[model samples]
Target chain A: MATLNLSAVTKSFGATTVLHGIDLNVADGEMIVIVGASGCGKSTLLRIVAGLETPTTGHVAIGGREVTRLEPADRDIAMVFQNYALYPHMTVAQNMAYGLKIRGTPKEEIARRVDETAGLLGIGPLLGRKPRELSGGQRQRVAMGRAIIREPKLFLFDEPLSNLDAKLRVQMRGEIRRLQQRLGVTSLYVTHDQVEAMTLGDRLVVMHRGRAAQVASPMEVWARPADTYVAGFIGSPAMNLLAGTLAEDGAAVQLRAGPLLRFTDGPRAGGEGRPLTIGIRPEHMLRDGDAIVTVALDLVEPLGSETVLHGTLASGEVLTARLPGMVPAVGSNMPLAIPAEALHVFDAETGRRLDA
Target chain B: MQDAVLARQAMARQRRGRWLAHAALALGVLIFAFPIWITLVGSTHDAATIGRGDVPLLPGGHGLENFSTALGEGGGRMHTTPAAGMLLNSAIMALLIAGGKIAISLLSAYAVVFFRFPLRMAAFWTIFITLMLPVEVRIIPTYQVIVNLDLFNSFTGLTLPLIASATATLLFRQFFLTIPDEYVEAAQLDGAGPLRFFRDILLPLSVTNIAAMGVILFIYGWNQYLWPLLIINDRSMETIVVGLAKMIGSGDTQNEWNTIMATAVLAMTPPVLVVVLLQRWFIKGLTETEK
Candidate 1:
């Protein structure tokens, strides 16, 4: 149980810089998930914390001890890899006991801990089996058991549940969240999946191109993304971003798709005719007779509880709407209103949020 | 009715092809086994019968006598050592060479694959390039080095020069590369240093490769004739292959063909036993490198 701090951590491979100075502070016993697309340096930041990779220039401290230059073993950290990375030649018990055995724990004590950890993981019957004999889910449990038996101050997970099927990923996600809370170990988890980030972390660090775009609670990030990149990344069906310009003295935005949507919160501090990007989430698009914009449907996906309509506006911009229950069939025009409170305005050129 | 006729034709054609394949394989087996059969038959015969150019195709009644004489006195030749002593020497040399080569190759391969140091690739290429210079190619320089070291007529001289095998090292290097990098990271987190990793993880994983390489290197050591002939002048240090060659003595005197044949059979037995014992593991190691 330790607080982790990474200050201005940067990494580069030869000429290409991967992580461009990321700084984050994780509270003790809190799980902070770093989520991003591939090649976005989330894994690199986690590895830097793990002492598996050295940052080009930065410092990492765990429990008030500087571990930037320490080896992973000396850093008092355990990592669960995506592939489980269980030593195939070892039985499950041996895998779980390996760290303690290497630390010269007594044989009896090692046995006792292996039994205890196996019981905790519900893998007692599997302790005698080799990794190859276990299913994918079983191997995942053993990997977690191996990390847990060490009782390290910090835990690092590199997309640990990404290898499982969808149903198992969900199940293991819940289990990992419960286990991390119960163990109360400070953890840094990296994943490309937004759902995992949303459900697993106490706070989420939505990364874009190596920098932390937003670091906040998941719901906070969802409701108020920091920029256009994060606004598009964290939600399913993605928030619809339309190109527009500030009009009526920055109190409203004039859409190229022939609608004037006013900012409800307050007037953004931008000059008139300033280019802007307006964001509206799919679930927030409401059906109204006198709507702001009209969409001619091209694709309609109907679930039992909701319908996702993919269409294009008359002014030639694609929009998706997730409405409750089924809507009309494809090729019909659906006039949807964008609620004023749901508007997310950003600078068109810089992609930064335009806050009032 | 037409479909049944076509099926019958197909079955008959398959049977014919099988027969043809079996015939070809039988011919190959005969071609390979003929010399060995002749040696077996010749060992059972009297020397006088073979000397008269009337070597029999079938076995003779003097098989036990010939074997005992070959084992006890080694054909009464002047330079030839007894079969038992030569067998012991050959066994020791083969076991040492195989074990030493495996040990050295495994360590070198582990170093090249796992560690990052200055000139690592240079070291690997240096080891790899030695494969081009086999013992037969650089035998004279090797002999001079052994002689200068004063290792003449010693088992150390006979086996040590043959111990560092480039092929085995390369094979192990390729095998080690197939191991995932995650295992190394996982082991690092487990607090295992290089030596512990090698002992706990690498050595156990390489059991099949060791068995396979053991079979190959044992045969290579057992069949060595030129190196042993160059270094060993003492009768006690003579290996079986060299002893067998010396038993004939340049075709000058009436040789004890029966004894020589019996010794040849005895010389082949140990290598064959090693291969037979480890055949299953050898095949598995060669074909399947996956975890």
Candidate 2:
């Protein structure tokens, strides 16, 4: 219902900086997901926004009200933790009612909201049962219901679906997305799973170490990752990054493995013989194209409809190609084509994108 | 014929082993129960019968008379009030001790585990060190403090010093540490400040431990003799345990053995009842296993 702004929010635990001056502006009713590997400080940034953690510097504002120093309850935000964190002794209804009850809502209002939320979550039958009696998925729903009943200005989810089994996790992920859309509440969800990030967020913040590496829509981040780190992080079979150099005319990159890959996206700000790291996604490695790259086969994975091939380049780096169905078992020298537009180039040393 | 004979011999040996095990178990049970059985029989008899050194093995005709007298007139010691007063005093003391210790310990433990305050560990260790110095170790100084405060012969003197031990606090601290950090965060988001969290979440979750600790502290408070003996001199304020011991009266030769035995039986009943009554909750282990 309201915009959230984090202006240079930094957090440090003792001497170790966990989140380094993170700045994000989430539009009203937008669900922005922060995704990263473990220790990347995505969770810390989320916590700082939640008011469970205090940022070492900068400000957090929700609905135009500065809440950097406010308590989570005072910040008007609800968070669903990874463990659900339902009060174990309380029944599902009581768990949902706790926040409103604490806020001194009228008895009937609290009861009505709790009942309505339970029904929305399809957990009405579980109202009287304590959290201990509920299944894992059921507990997760109750945890969500606990947050939704508050009807807070914003919702924060810290990998809420991580605890469920893979199948359940997918189901819950879709449900969470659906609920958030239906409610149209501003939400920030943090997770390490790229698929969840891609599917759930209006925009994805791909974090690396203590900083946001790339913040863009899912498809934008996929098609044009801001850096080599994000490119490697987003795809299923990660983008194959090879050490290459700009061609003498600056129109293409010459691979150390002796393949001349042309650039079709745009001309980059790099000179001839400029050392660069060139990336090509697995799915975009085409079998029919004008540009050809010869590779030595290392391994192959047959995943039903499509077969993914892993090959060793001449420079002794791994290259992957995802091609559709029944690839004839090619010998040592496997000839493959990579379309030019799918190529991503970054400065070799800094790892920053050169195709800006 | 030889095979059949061997099988029969083996069966006989197994029977003998079973008989021996049962006999040993019965002997162990008897050894533990003998004193209680004798006390029960002794409590039922007249003073003349027990005083002649012929303790009866069965209930005597004086059972009702002995109980009624004990209940109505106490042990007949000088200025001795009825067993009812002493029983009430004991009940008050025990409940207060258990309840006071639990309340204090729970609060202190919550503070130590959840909050980050200056000198927190110092306070915890200070409390923890009290475990080394039980009331029995520092009785005289404690007694002096009670006397200086004009708390003598009062319930305050009897229960206050006993409540200062750190076992309950340390026990609760350990239990509090096992609670997940997420719950604390969840409560904070739920707008429950420390006190509310303590009342609603921590206390309810600790029901079994509190019950278990209650059983222990009640017995500890009930069986107290030395501390109460030194503090309360008023016959009206006497606990049943201490009063039962007082009936022997500093080498009084005319002590009524039947009344004393009846009072001993009375002293044993409340603590046994408390344990029996709270036993269900006492045995339910900590952690709801719901997660």
Candidate 3:
């Protein structure tokens, strides 16, 4: 197993920069997932680490050996592509043995490794079948087997489960996490799916527009995002954001949202009279007449376990609330409570966390 | 009574249509087969008898006699037989040319399709330009080059000038373009070098195109006339087509129609057999037209 490190890595396709300078250190045998939206260069960063792409600047070191200029095969890293990229002409066993064969491994040893990996992947019965005969999930297992037989220092996965159906994707995600844990291999995974990143990552690197927005554990990123972008992007149904200002009211600080509601809590220091964006998660908002703000329900989506209510606060800003049970019918006016502790405050102009 | 009459009339018309279609098809088949039948029938008669146009359409019971005479088995003073030597020469030349053309075209196509190099587009256009310039147009200069290389009257001389046809290169290039780039990338990741990739991946996947091109190149080499006639003067080195010309040029005293026809049939056998055997691949290769 190896610890991978990217030091000040940058990439560009001509004048258009895809990855700004990125620095990250992944601990040995740790699973680090890089998540971002499309055009965010998360996949490019993964490719750079896998040695399939060359960074325009900086260095890539794996297991303390610099491999920025090395070929993928020479770097001794195995990548499971999003498309699987299995050799369609070869049977499953041959596909798994290809890397070993190319390295001039003995026939018996190659067969033994391939057999063991196939067994581990639960694909032993599919040894003689070609990739075309295998289903998407089966092909994914063979691809992983191909990489595992090499027993490389590190494993790189570029959205490996994205091609499967929703249910299969979930199943494969569990399988991959289980395999990675069992093998105890250092792995770098890239995905745009927040749920996958949250569940699979030991450390999550949230990227936006080619730069790391926040690098933290999943729960830490959820609870304390670095910026308004992280707060909105990291959560399902997204975090509710409203423009307001913090005002000093004697011993407590009140977040005044126009003339309709005022949220008071800790004492204000320099935040008074400054424009700020107040953030709240859907699950954090509750319906209580005792709270400061009142809202008119615009829509309700009952998802069996939880109902998401879409409505506008009295300040004319939209907000969503996830209630424990089915919410009232659409267009029902209700008073909503904003618990002071669940509130996230960000600088309205800069979008940076105000408390950071 | 009126309905029955109409049904009977329709049945009659349908029968007539089928009869007319069969009649036309028979006429077309006869048009194609008549000359070959005439040639076979004429081969059983003496030259004078064939020239008189009075030879019976059926075999005259002189088939073996005519063949023996044509094959130089008659021991006649005027008899000339070079059929065996001509067939051997044609086979050797065709085999060399077909093999060389396939090797050259496959390598060039693979390189053009898979690699990045300076002057790649220039090389592709150069090969494409040759398609417009027929072999007959370049025969003089090509012949001079062969003569300068001391390859005159050699089998290598006969086959080397025809090795760089643009059709085979273009065909193979188009075929190779259909192969997914992922396959090459996968092989590269697996640590395969260029030669290994070509042999294990590219070549195996191109069997249909190779078979199709091989049949075409074999036929072109087999039926070559003008160039071989100009370059090869030795009787022992003459190909079947050139040897046929030589036989036909001789006076009637030495010319035997039956032997000539037998030799002609033998000379045409290999190409016809190849086309028959690889017809499926030939059609498939042409029909795909993949870019």
Top candidate on DockQ is 1
Which clashing pairs does model 3 show? none
Give the TM-score (0 to 1) of chain B in model 2: 0.91
Residues forming the 10-long window of minimal summed lDDT in candidate 1 chain A: A285-294
Model 3, A117: alpha-carbon shift in Å?
Answer: 1.1
- Which lDDT tens digits does candidate 3 get at residues A190-259? 9999999999999999999999999999999999988899999999899998786666542223455443
- Which tens-of-lDDT digit does each residue in B1-291 have in candidate 2? 999999999999999999999999999999998888888888888888888889788988787888888888888455366888999999999999999999999989999999999999999999999999998999889989999999999998889999998999988898889899999999999999988999999888888899889999999989888998999889889888888877776654766788888888888988889879988877774433223
Q: For residues A1-356, what per-residue lDDT tens digits would candidate 2 score against the true structure?
A: 79999999899999999988889999999999999999999999989988999999999999999999998889999999999999988988889999999999999999889888988999999999998898889999999999999999999999998889999999999999999999999999999999999999999999999999999999999989999999999999999998989984778888887778777765667678889998889998988787777778867788989999988876888889999996756456788887878888999999998864
Global Cα lDDT for candidate 1: 0.91
lDDT of candidate model 2 versus the reference: 0.90
Worst 10 residues of 3 chain A by lDDT: A250-259
Give candidate 2 misplaced runs (Cα > 4 Å): A288-298, A328-333, B1-24, B76-81, B249-255, B286-291
Stretch of 10 with least lDDT, candidate 2 chain B: B282-291
Which stretches in model 1 have alpha-carbon errors above 4 Å? B76-79
- lDDT string, candidate 1, A105-183, tens digits: 9999999989988888899999999999999999999999999999999999999999999999999999899999999
| Candidate 3 residue lDDT tens string, B99-212 | 899999899988888898999999999988988877698988998999999999998888888776788889889888877765676676788888988987777667777888
Candidate lDDT values, in order: 0.91, 0.90, 0.83
